[model samples]
Target chain A: QKEVEQDPGPLSVPEGAIVSLNCTYSNSAFQYFMWYRQYSRKGPELLMYTYSSGNKEDGRFTAQVDKSSKYISLFIRDSQPSDSATYLCAIGGTYKYIFGTGTRLKVLA
Target chain B: EAGVTQFPSHSVIEKGQTVTLRCDPISGHDNLYWYRRVMGKEIKFLLHFVKESKQDESGMPNNRFLAERTGGTYSTLKVQPAELEDSGVYFCASSQAPGSEETQYFGPGTRLLVL
Candidate 1:
């Protein structure tokens, strides 16, 4: 089975709408969960990360990890056009770094 | 301090040509990593370096690709007789260590187009 799975969504939302992105993993050994944002032609940038199961909030971004369910999520509150990009969910197992096919997010102004 | 930097932001070469992509990690970082994203696929790890030593290279696709981190500094990934399937965006990232919490800074990435 694939280690991590995410919907490759071209999800469009009106500006100011709340955006939620999610991923599910099959490995319980994954202890590190993270969200990265990538703009065209640029590399992925670390948005927020959480260890194990917990919710971390940074400004308008919130990252939640549910270890029991092997699920994780990133929520962007008060989204704006500047928030448009590809959102990638990454998980780290003991030996490898696994990433999901990113969800393309567009916050239309 | 400058973030990770990669050379030749984009390269377009025909199959069978060799292409060398370079990455300069942030100074003082002891860990370096290489990842690639093919069209319609997720970004995948290729290999990782600790100083001049390879910590793990299990993700490398095959023998056609070779990566070197000589003298514990800048690194290079070379693809000989590149295949059309080898086209992708190659990203280089570095971190102080592989802790559960340390941030991995990324380079601008080099786009390789093998036609």
Candidate 2:
């Protein structure tokens, strides 16, 4: 089985809608959970990072980690068209990183 | 300060050809990394460099691929006699602190197409 699994989504949402993206992993040793945003032809940018199972809030984005189920999520409040991008979930050790297939998001005005 | 930058934003070569991709990490950053992603696949770690030394290179796929970070400033990944399966985007990233690496800044990867 793959270590990390995420649904490849072309999820579409209306402007100002709440968007929820998620990923599940089977690796119990993973300590770092991160979310990244990527635009076309650009590198992925770190959006949310968590050290363990818990919740973190940053501006309009919220990240939640549930280590028990090995599930993590990123919630975008009042999503805008400008917020449209590919969302990637990544877990890593001190020296290496593993990524999940990203979910493509589009917010229409 | 500018983020990491990669050269030859895109490359197209035939199978069995040699291709070299370059990465210019952020200045003063001691940690450099290489990664790749094929079409519809996730970005993957290929190797990590600490200045002029390779701290971790376990992710490299095969002997046909070679990576070097000389002088601890810029790095290069060369694929000799590239295979059809080698067609993918190669990325380079760097971190600010040498210890407990965090928030790796990535370059606009070099998209490679092997025909």
Candidate 3:
């Protein structure tokens, strides 16, 4: 089984909608949960990072980690057209990083 | 204050040909990593380096791939006699701190196509 799993979504949402992205993992040792945003033809950039199983709010974005369920999520409030990008969840470790198949999001104007 | 930078933003080579990709990590970053993502696949780790030394390379697929980080400043990944399966986007990342929680900054990957 893969260590990290995420839906490969081409999820579309209207402008001003709320967008939710999520991932599930099997490793209990994972301590850091991170979300990265990747635009077409560009590298992924860190958007949200959490070290605990709680919610972290940053502007219009919120990252939640549920260690007991081994699940994590990123929520975008009032999504905009400029928010179109691929959201990737990464599990960080000392030796390697396991990345989820990103969910491609498009916010229509 | 530059983020990681990768050379040859894109590459196309005939099967069995050799290709070399380069990465310049963020200055003073002691940890460097290499990853690849094939078409429709998630990005996968290739190797990790710490100050000119390879800390872990278990992700490297086979003998045709080689990576080197000289002086722990810049690194290079060379694929000799590359195969069709070697086509992918090669990404390099660096973290200033070696801790597991340190955020890693990634470079725009080198998209490789082996025909």
Candidate 4:
């Protein structure tokens, strides 16, 4: 099984809508969870990260991790056109870190 | 203090040719990583370097790929006889230390196209 699985969504939403992106992992050893945003022609930028099962809020972005279920999510509240980009979920195992197929989001103005 | 930076923002080369991509990590960072994203695929890890030493390189696709970090400074990735499947965006990242919780900062990435 792939270490991390994420829906490659070209999801479109109106501005000010709340967006939820998620990923699942089969590995139970993953302790670090992160959300990264990537713009066209640019590398992934760290959005928010959580160490364990819980929700972390940073401005309009919220990252939640459920280690028990091996699930993680990134919630964007009041999303704007500037939030239009690819969102990637990453998890770190003991030996290495793995990334998911990013979800492309377009917040239409 | 600059974030990670990569050179040759875009490169288009014919197959079987050689290409070298460079990366300058954040100053004072001890941990550097190389990643690649093929067309329509997720970004994948290539290797990890600790200072001038290679900490882990199991993600390298094959023997045609080589990476180096000299003097614990900048790093380079060289692909000899590049293939069509090798076309992808190459990303370089770095962190202060492997143990630290600080997130890895990424470069703008080098977009490589092999024809």
Using all chains and alpha carbons, the TM-scores for the candidates as numbered come to 0.97, 0.96, 0.98, 0.97
Better of 3 and 4 by DockQ: 3
Which residue ranges in model 1 land beyond 4 Å of their true spot? Answer: B99-101
Considering summed lDDT, which 10 consecutive residues are worst modelled in model 2 chain A? A89-98
Tell me the TM-score for chain B of model 3: 0.97
**Roughly what TM-score does model 1 have, to 2 decimal places?**
0.97
Could you tell me the lDDT of residue A51 within candidate 1?
85
Give lDDT tens digits, candidate 2, residues A53-100: 889999999999999999999999999999999999988767677899
DockQ, each predicted model: 0.67, 0.65, 0.79, 0.61
lDDT of 2 at B94: 93
Please provide, for model 1 over B1-115, each residue's C-alpha lDDT reduced to its tens digit, 9 standing for 90 to 100. Answer: 9999999899999999999999999999888999999999999999989898998899899999999999989999999989999999999999987644576888999999999
* Regions more than 4 Å wrong, model 4: none
Model 2 DockQ class: medium
In candidate 2 chain B, what residue range of length 10 has the lowest lDDT sum?
A: B96-105
Best by TM-score: 3
lDDT of 4 at A109: 100
lDDT of 4 by residue, A10-71 (tens): 99999999999999999897888889999887889999877879899999999999889999
Report, for all candidates in order, the number of backbone clashes. 0, 0, 0, 0
* Cα-based lDDT at residue B90, candidate 2: 96
- lDDT sort, best first: 3, 1, 4, 2
